[model samples]
Target: MPDIKCSVTECEYNSDVKCGAPMIQVDHNNVPKSNNSDQTKCDTFRAKG
Candidate 1:
């Protein structure tokens, strides 16, 4: 756990302001290489049921 901070309340892995997933998978969206946070997204995010 890298102590990831999360704010996507709709995600199941979000506990408070921290991520509770065993691990986080983040990758660039569309762009071949991301140069900023806005270009990346969390692949570990699962919608809360």
Candidate 2:
């Protein structure tokens, strides 16, 4: 299988190799609600370290 690169720079899972999981689950509601509905962020994000 091809490697998955994590987009989050703080996540230890993020590496030049691949993401630890085949897929990551993210909740949109977890993101802080903002006036700019177009904006998005992952509240569940955690550094692998």
Candidate 3:
């Protein structure tokens, strides 16, 4: 675990501004690095209703 911090309150795995998921996948468009937060997405994100 990399101690991922998250603030997506609507995600089922988000709790107290932290990620409670067993594992998280950060997806990028085959880029070596992302210059902004919008360039990536949390593949582990699951909608909370």
Candidate 4:
């Protein structure tokens, strides 16, 4: 499995700066061919609250 680094402390799937989920999806379809990280989002993100 690839190592996925995450910094969203509020996400339930985040643990020790890593993703604990079995899988993750990067949704950049809204901004195709974009090189900006801000333009993309983690669809698997789930708020802990």
lDDT of 1 by residue, 1-49 (tens): 6688788979998888899999788899889999998999999899999
Please write out the lDDT profile of model 3 over residues 1-49, one tens digit for every residue. Answer: 8777788989999889899999888898467788887878898899998
TM-score leader? 1
**Number of residue pairs clashing in candidate 4, backbone atoms closer than 3 angstroms, sequence gap of 3 or more or interchain:** 0
Candidate 2 residue-wise lDDT, 1-49, digit = tens: 3565656667765666456654565545544665553454544466776
Which stretches in model 2 have alpha-carbon errors above 4 Å? 1-5, 29-40
TM-score, one value per model = 0.90, 0.38, 0.75, 0.78
Q: Distance (Å) between predicted and true CA of 14, model 4?
A: 0.4
By summed lDDT, the worst window of 10 consecutive residues in model 1 runs over 1-10
Model 4 alpha-carbon drift over 4 Å, by segment: 29-33
Predicted candidate 2: what Cα RMSD to the true structure? 4.6
Q: Which of the two, 2 or 4, has more TM-score?
A: 4
- TM value for model 2: 0.38
User: Among all windows of ten consecutive residues in candidate 3, which has the lowest summed lDDT?
Assistant: 29-38
Candidate 2 residue 29 Cα shift, in angstroms, is 4.2
Error of 3 at 12 (Å): 0.1
